[model samples]
Target: MKIMIDAGHGPDTPGKRVPDDSMREYEFNSSTARRVVAALNDYKDVQVEITFEDTRDVPLKERTNKANAWEADLFVSIHANAVGDYWDDNVGGIETYVYLYPGTVAPKLAAIIQSKLIAYTGLRDRGVKQEDFHVLRETVMPAILCECGFMSNHHEADLLKADSYRQKSADAIVDGIAEFYGLSKDSPDLVPGNGNQTIDKGWWRKAMNLTIEQWRELAAELNRMYQDSVSGKIIPPVLNDYRWVEKAYKTEMTPEELLTVMSIIQMRRIV
Candidate 1:
């Protein structure tokens, strides 16, 4: 599924910062958005597009237009909330929003995100709300905007600045989306030469006499080979065999190619 992630506002956007000016809203938003993209990559059959930049504030119309043009399945806008650009110890919590007239799918998406955020962050549940935000209203797909915490609140501001909190927030958002769509993590099953058979993890340990760490190292090497193959730094042996075939393709390597690369790597290890 195609997902669009928007980091709300920009570095230069006026007044979207902590009262002490220690942190910008875009810093938190963009950081969390990036983490969300990386986390989502672990899921199979998922594609993500980020709609905002670090340098400039992208207009809401442009952000929604890009999602619409890409025909994205879902759109998520990430932001840090504030009230009146001043510090307040009392105002803090997590909230998520859908369009005022959100359709069936958007409300469900918003609820899932809201619940996950509160669960993971241990933040107060501000609950799901409806707003006529430009991104939510203009995007054709199901879209939701998340207000992670109030920048106006000093306590929440500190949490937003921490890497651990950003990571947890990103994970919660990805988990929510995955739950809604029933996404599975990429697994060895995506590898080609196993004849669609599920490999038992225990069997790999017994047959290869390799610890879990060793298996992970091997997988990491295979992943490097796949990256090299994709970048044209090196042609995977399997690809040379299919050079004569013509087919439409995405920028990402296909499952068959990835599987064949793994097979070749495994054979080399045995030899």
Candidate 2:
């Protein structure tokens, strides 16, 4: 079967950047496309056709046109996630999207890719979602978009730079495709030039590591504290202790201290 691998965004889109300003989304997405193509190429039974060879000049519509013309069995658009203004690149994680009301295999294909991305990347699973995407909506086959990690997040930006991640990312994409189309080891649909199609049993272990509900609770609590401090609604014990307030950065100073002592120290003079 033929597969169209579209590395989303073209040469026109410089795409997003990292905190250290080291990694670019265009570079990451393009590199991932290459890795995916190579892996699929290894399977002679599959013909991996890439739509975005030179992202610098490739137009989004043109890429979609290529996929439609190819009559591919599936189309996977690889991309990284980015949010907010350039000054604060913070929100990120893997969110694989399928067209809002896609064809029969759209949901199934997205599920296959989304599960594998979290399993191998060790990143937060943003879950499989629906987006009114132009490419996925117009494409003739099952499609998915992978937002690998957040470019705004400082820690994840560092992780994306590692060389090993590229290979693993490619493996995840390839393995997922193989599994989705009933192309298991016994299937003749398996990629050619391989004796056995290895399954990643370790996926379960990685999946058990991250849970979104836990983080959501943590964020909720943090916001609640900030709100309480603003409204003077916090516990009196914490507010009364000058040192504790300072530790939490909620209050100004020790009430017991004389005005003379407080006036003596200027805001500029104090750390």
Candidate 3:
């Protein structure tokens, strides 16, 4: 499945940022998009594309239009939350948001995202919420704006700043997306660099971040399950990274590649 990733605001917006002024919502959103995009690439059956890239200020309407244009399966806008109504020195938690809709998929997605975010980061769960935000209210598909962690809170602000946390947060979102919808992980087109014939045949088109791996040769560090699977050697551990091939997408995976990708995903054991 193809999904649209929108970083809430541009770099120069002077938008939401941490209290100490170190991090901004744009930074957090963009970085999480990148991490999620990178992490999801293993499935080979999914494809992810950012609505707008590099300094391009895609308006809220334009972002939704892009998703509509692509008929994207889901629309995810990432952001960091503010501290409080009065700016007290304390406050922190994870909140997943959707527009006001009764018994809609948005709320379900929000709840799953909220739970996974809490589980992955050990952050406080503010719970799923409904708000009439422009992006949330206007998007046609299942749309959710994740205020991943509170930039206002001292501990969460610092914690959200870490790449490890950001990566894990992105992974949690991807996993939630996969489970919520009955999307498949099969990718019949993924090629193992079999040659130009395989490349021209175009089996790897769905993946956004799919690329030739760095260490083409199997390393000893690779799990026995993957080595065994390649030759009926052993059963692979789910989401072991070394066992999974990164697909470069954030939406959903095809059925054919699902089990293989899960075996290769290193972070599968995370959440």
Q: Which 10-residue span in candidate 1 carries the lowest summed lDDT?
A: 242-251
Model 1 alpha-carbon miss at residue 56, Å = 0.8
**Model 3 global lDDT (CA atoms, 0 to 1):** 0.64
Better of 1 and 3 by lDDT: 1
Candidate that would win on lDDT: 1
> Where in model 2 is the C-alpha error above 4 Å?
11-15, 87-90, 184-271
Per-residue accuracy of model 1 over 1-271 as CA lDDT, tens digit each = 9999999999999998999999999989987886676667657888877899766999889999999999999999999999867888888899999985524598898899899999999999999998989999898889999999999998899999986688679879999999999999875432333555443232233333444333333433443343345457764443322111111111123546444544665654343
* Clash pairs detected, candidate 1: none
Models 1 onward score TM values of: 0.71, 0.64, 0.67
Evaluation by lDDT, superior candidate among 2 and 3:
3
At residue 271, give the lDDT of candidate 2: 20
Candidate 2 C-alpha error for residue 269, in Å: 72
lDDT of 2 by residue, 96-162 (tens): 8988562367787788888898899888888999888888888877888878877777766665665
Would you list the rank order by TM-score, best first? 1, 3, 2
Those runs of model 3 whose alpha carbons end farther than 4 Å from true positions after fitting are 84-89, 184-271
Candidate 3, 38-114: lDDT as tens digits: 54444445666677554756788888888888888788888888854234446777788888666568788778877
List RMSD in Å for every model shown. 12.0, 21.5, 9.6
